[model samples]
Target: MSADIPATYTAARPAATAEVSRQAWLVWLTSERRAARLTVETYGRDLAGFLGFLTRHLGAEPTLADLARLTPADFRGWLAEAAADNLSNATRAKKLSAVKSFLRYVERDHGIAVAAIGLVATPRARKPLPRALTVIDARAIATEIGEVSDVAALQARDTALFTLLYGCGLRISEALSLDRGQAPLPGSDAPLRVMGKGGKTRIVPVLPLAREMMARWVALHWQPAGDAPLFLGARGKRLDAAIAQKSLRTFRRQNGLPEHATPHALRHSFATHLLAQGADLRAIQDLLGHASLSTTQRYTEVDTAQLMAVWRRSHPRA
Candidate 1:
């Protein structure tokens, strides 16, 4: 009877395995009440990896019960072992993230209660200070881009893009993604509409220099369509972030700016300059699309450091 057992079992097994994965994905998607689609997808991939690991190491599929039995200590042991294997902090963090997310999904979807996974404590990553050029360095880089007279159109475009970034504190992605009709510049009473992180929309005031540079670029191109990209590539396509970074690099090299100069440095410079000018921290947070004033407050620290440096140089005391 065992020898006569059907090939149908083998065929049905594959289908059953696929169905289980599909159901796991769906459960992950639908289980969390407030989870974003992207979050669900990320956790789904993580859970899948966890399940795969269980299959390999334990020689049995892990159920919600198996996950519930996991403690923070167990998770930490896994992380420590991974680190001992010379895995980078980033990779180990990603793996732990997958484990933690799976445990949460098991609790939510399978009604299996586990202790809070946050107790596992992810590895602390060093928070690098934001790199922002000094106002003089910013002006020098902008001037270098503007002075590339061999390509008038490209020069105007780069000048306007960097001006919008540094002058108005716009993200490089936001500036590149601007639509043609979104302009005529925000009036003193009205702020410009900007789409920021997580598809949230916010209004930011347009500075005079940003308005003037944009207006000049628009006049030069004369594209009347409302839906056209505010900044375009050679073929009139939306400007790519990589291309903008490359252009900034060329300008940086020509102008002798520091090695850390990047498009984002302009944004950092914007916030730092605003703080130097006594702009409110909350107001700067709104302009820079920072979700928290704490994030914006880093620029205040930058401003404070600069003030201290100046005081040390100018003070009569040694």
Candidate 2:
């Protein structure tokens, strides 16, 4: 949370003491909720914004007692104030959500139910579809990344990385976090364990083609065993994702692929391609390590569009 808005109450100890519950709730979010770093950071900022407003609005530190008596009008005033400060509806909505969550925590931990917060509704926002590459384009990009590099080792490393992006459906961070011990033996069919968002681990089945490429790359490169990084920078440290992103960016630009041709685009293509092949949404969710099935269902939209395109192009009735 930004420290700028402390507009602190004169009774510093009272204010600070009253804030202990918030800290405890944050700890619960970390340990029990397993909230992502960005989620925790955003929630903290939203709560800080609310508390800062209360300091100004109430002319005193807000206690749990103060929170309990807040009417719907008080909530509306807070949203209105945030709007006057030019916070977008999306941001105001997020702030309200954080405040609501904090109050719910207070209710659970301290028996102070701020049920009024439930009356506030979130602002609706348009959801965008995931951008996915066509199967041909995804394969072409991976093949080019492997073959087009100047150095043999670098070529092999990049090939393995891109292959994982497409073949294993790994997020760039997940793929780059791989170590030497993760390299499956040639022709081995064991599943690869990937630690994804929010520190959740999921097992991903390795395609034989992906395994072959990975084994061949390991054979041609350094760090085949022990705990060194599976992919390396020029200095031989664990590879930075920016380098991988840059490599993809350069390849896309040269190959005339769309600008969205990113490492993540490979992952989008992974799920979309799977959905196109009639894979179950639940299975894809498991492979992508998504906590919500709705997140995986976005690929259905992509697949539907592709099906429409094929129908338009190939059907005689069209």
lDDT per model vs. reference: 0.72, 0.82
Tens digit of per-residue lDDT, candidate 1, span 1-318: 266766644332322342264356556567745667776777666556556655655567755555556667756666776778787777777777766655555455445566747687777664556777899988766556777546788888888888877777778898888889885453443567889998988888777767777777887787779998889888889999998888888777877878888888988888887777888889888887888777877777777777798899999993
Instruction: Identify the leading candidate in terms of TM-score.
Output: 2
Report the lDDT tens digits of candidate 2 across residue range 1-318: 356545432222233334666677788899999999889888887887888788788897788778887888788888989889988778888888888888887766666777677787776554778999988899988777865579988888888789888998899999988888988657677899888889999999988777777877888765546788888888878889999888888888888889999999999999999888889999999999999998898899988888899999999998
Q: Please report the TM-score between candidate 2 and the true structure.
A: 0.61
Candidate 2, which segments miss by more than 4 Å at Cα?
Answer: 1-122, 310-318
Judged by whole-model lDDT over C-alpha atoms, candidate 1 comes out at 0.72
Error of 1 at 93 (Å): 10
